[model samples]
Target: MPIGILTTDTGKLVEIRETITLNSDAFSNSFHEDLQFHFNNERIPERVVHAKGGGAFGYFEVTHDVSKFTKADVLNGVGKKTEVFVRFSSATEQLGGNDAARDIKGLSVKFYTKEGNWDLLCLSTPVFFFKDPIHFPSFFHAMKRNPKTNLIDFSMRWDFVTKQPESLNGFLYLLSDYGIPNGYRKMDAFAIHTFEINNKHGDKYFVRFNFRTEQGEEALTSAEARAQDPDYYNKDLYNAIEKKNYPIWKLEMDVMTLNDIKRVDYDPFDVTRLWKKGTYTTVPIGCLVLNKNPDNFFRTVELSAGNPGNLVPGIPGPLDNLFRSRRMMYRQTQVHRLKVNHNRIRINEPLYWKVYNRDGRPPVRENMKDAPNYYPNSYNGPVPYIDPARPKERFTIYERNAVDLEPAAYFYNHYLCDEGQRQRLVNNTAQSLVPVSPYLQQRALRLLSLTDPQLGIRVAECLEEALETPTPAPHAIKIPRHPYEGNKHYVHL
Candidate 1:
């Protein structure tokens, strides 16, 4: 490589790069352009969710071969390793918000493999707030701040949640002790949706990934979290790595055959519910270790973006509505936030790649010189791989419909075995719902009653007590607007 000292954006030699002195007429063109270029593009849009995040550089090492499950080259054999970048975030919080806040955690990983980049997008909780993509905006608006007051409103939050009974399970999980994890290293992660994977024999299977932290799971109560430092998680991670203590997570997966899904009682692909834990076996895939801290936070951590669409050859496109909707939304937001060539950014870019995509804003590399831009040309170009091992997806025809609170109720009544845990769930639910109106409170009680009778009765009693002596809060004094009221902009108000 030639030794060249130049500006990062334009690759021009450094000449007259300094600003003009007070007595001079004007600054050099390079100086002015570099300043303007940097000033104009200093920041990109933060993620609508997962706004606050920290990341590290590491490698994912294959511990057990999964060749029978998928033909993805990264997981083909034991001892195989690939470079990875993992970003951990707290969803529903601003960039400056506290890390130990009681919220869902985002676990996004990018594997730079021999074939291409593969992103494993996941969350700390196994289930989500709702199943349908249409409820996405409503759910976030409810969880987020009230527009007029710029404060969290329990009335708005409980109203939408109570109406969508499917969200009750996830809501209960968030209100539990597991909600406020001690730190990123102590939390478990799950791929919240079903993914399609194929083997070299063209055999396909529905799969869900689970990453349990080897550090052992730990969490803090609401009072404990409030007493600790806000950025405790971020600082703990950085300090752990600096002290040569790397955090690790083992990758386990649940595999279901085509016939297995048919026999299951619930929808296997529902994001709001999980596959019964004992019904399927969890195969050990690999282990991920985060060992290096980022040198530049903005360059590596802030600009990094991952999507469900960035899949390898072995893992074909997902067919679930939630997965499909996320692919489209991720692309739209990435393009809007970081331009069409967002992947070309340093941390997100693939280690080795070739493509016909060229000539866009921030064209950093050689624009495939003297090569035909279109396909079917005489010159060599990237061609589509019609793989011999491509699996034929099994299609089912049926009217997709939503169910009531049966699944959420089942989990609460059966899965939660501890008496103390049950009591905590009831207390958390009551404390949060106490500020809302009686109508919404009763609605929540009805939904919870369907799940577990005692849960509903207990919450009802708490509400009755709370109603006799209501808490003094600003939001409780007035009626709340519609959940989507603040979404639209007023041009001539």
Candidate 2:
């Protein structure tokens, strides 16, 4: 029996089988039952974060030459196009939660460059909750509901920010209308992390990706978002593609030079801050248009794997602690949940294929028998290596003291230069943390004082004066999710 497909000039490409018709396959519950029963015995682990989502197919076309800034080929070719798939989801919500709800949506993009895959794991907002990756678990604990009670606790979120005063920049964006996006297509996506690009000459500059939506920026009011359908984002994407109003965004980048990094008051590698490290701001790079929707949601949208480790030539990795943590965590989680063949799924293996990484469960054998399974085997095996003429790798980071990632190795003080910035940080803290226990609140304020005095005093005065702070708007209710909350569901097959 042969698989059937509708090809050019053929009415229908069908294989005539003596025992069964293709139509009969529709009633094949037993086949499904056997697999699903096995699946039930197993489990589908939810992403510890970014639980629910929708994705689409598109191409990211280079619209400008950024060769002077970075060696990334995708940024060099003015008219070059790289295939892309983007998935949007609320970071804290479960799979069936409201899409337009007040929450940070994970804006993840995968660029299938000629060299390899490049994954940008970003939040809709440019800044994040915390800068130092060492405080990662603390940030999650703050966002999540109290362990004792399943309900949300503002005290948790406030506690963490209160301790980490530097988080004000990111928290302000969240409290503002920018927190809730109307839909995936209406939001400005980001390559939030600071990356470095090396040219063939071995010169390097910091890089950040900015994706401005062509449909225009839009956000729903908290009330409006709450009342909308749970699948609002998913519906908007699907319907737009159906109507041919294909969504698009231009890929822009802020390339900061080495001198730029030295001058900025903030560390560009800090995921928690968003400031131009260089004299030059975002340079026009390319445009990405999502024109095709997924054929199967589970295989593509839900199971898609993304990691910063997949980079092509000209594009080099930044030694950010968060990025390094993700490389190990993401690769481990994907293997643990979806198996080693997750990339072999049609949704992920659109054009690029790695031949040597064969002989796994769910293997599609994309290249067939001609391709060797082992590299440098007796037969002609896959011997692809780093292109020497492309971007050369940058400075190597010694891992001797980077293992525990001690606080001394991470914390920075340059972002506290401004009195207004300090005041705003303190004021925001005092206002947000007043409701918590006085002991904890005072402890937090004391910690803020460690970083900056004005910060500590203002927060104390603000909290003292906030005797009757008004209740947050009904829709202002927030529930944060931890990094590990959704991972328990995954069971190894």
Candidate 3:
């Protein structure tokens, strides 16, 4: 049998050239055109956040029934297994950045169910830096490298966190030993935001999703993490899956009713605050086991885009400000990076479906054929799902305090039971703030002091030791022109 001949993008075969020369004529060949196309279009824009990542194919088995909470078919019965692709990433870095850096780790999962794709986009930490979505850009910008010097600016970060005050909870976690996980498998994951679930009877409940690592939580110290390979976490996950030692995470839910929201001291919808375990019953619904590694990392892992908005029926999200912003941003970013027809990509696409979307750049599937693309046509068109019988869901969120430093202070003083861990947190935070302007340093210290007076004084002492001088008095410093400006260098003894 003859091998298949190569063709151009338009499927035109090349004829034998009578006279071939290594000149301008060589560029006319479709082969050359194909090569140029491939070369120019090899890379897509990396994710705005969670850029450095590793992922695997997995199965999430519903071990326990939660039919009363959600009408989703995947969780309706025990022993049911849904195919999933899970991606673990560092939240604040580019593609080539270190995976084990002291940053929040993104844990996103795409479940390919018969109904549609359901994504549970989560983070390693339970709470986030800010509760409002409007501050999203500013927060990221602060965490990112400085524009002028192209270096990580600790002062910019400290300025933003100190000013916001609400970010203390997350700042505390990010500075603790838990900030750097031993590997993806050793880390627990949280939805970080509340979501709503509906039952067959149309009953609704707000819940926070938690995925506890079966491997047990383990983290590396700053020195220990820096000593290992930057890609240590990625290698660990890949190697473990290759050896059939699959990593497992148990799916747990903290259920809260409408009445429970009023009972809580903090805003239930605030991503910056966590709901205590005692406030709601902990129920285990399923377990995820990653048993297969991606054959091509770039294709299967890098190209996969998971969004919280890609939810199936029965699993709907709340009206949380951050959640709404994320839903919009996720769609926009994916479209910008992967093109309008991004969902058609193999890794991102569902098993089978016919949607109204059509005729975009490099569409992979059928162009909807002769079906009526427009909705509300008498000639037969898909109709939106509506259930009037469902009870109306309503709730209220009052002005919760963001400036309260109690959480961070409490975590530092009581949560870190080990004196060594508490000392490490203080040292890490102080070292990070060393390069910042004294004004910003004092501002951050003031916020920390609100958390605990002793904690603040200790951090101040550590900052003084690192700077080899006293922290500048807050009222004496002059403001800079640029809003986010910082000191270049700090004097050392």
- Which candidate leads the pack in TM-score? 3
| Model 3 lDDT per residue over 377-448, tens place | 877556776865355766545545546666676678777779999888999999898998879988988888
Q: Write the per-residue lDDT of candidate 1 for residues 254-298, one digit (tens) a residue.
A: 999877877887777788887886567779999999999999999
Per-residue lDDT of candidate 2, residues 1-493 (tens digit): 7475523222433233412435666344344444456777654888777788899888888887777766766667788888888888888777667787657888778887765678877778876766456776677666755889965677787666665666655665664456677898899877677777777677787778788888988877555776888988999999999899999888787777777777775455766655643356768887888889888788788878887777767677777776778787788888887888877766666365557765677865554567766657887765666656454445543322211111211222343444554444445455557668877777766665664565567668888778566766676766889888987786789
Cα error, residue 49 of model 3, in Å, equals 1.3
Cα shift from native, residue 491, model 1 (Å): 50
Could you report the Cα RMSD, in angstroms, for every candidate shown? 8.6, 10.5, 9.7
Model 3 misplacement above 4 A: 1-25, 385-389, 396-402, 468-493
Q: Per the 3 Å backbone cut-off, how many clashing residue pairs does candidate 2 have?
A: 3
Error of 1 at 81 (Å): 0.8
| TM-scores of the candidates in the order shown | 0.87, 0.74, 0.88
Clashing pairs in 2: 45-490, 143-480, 251-286
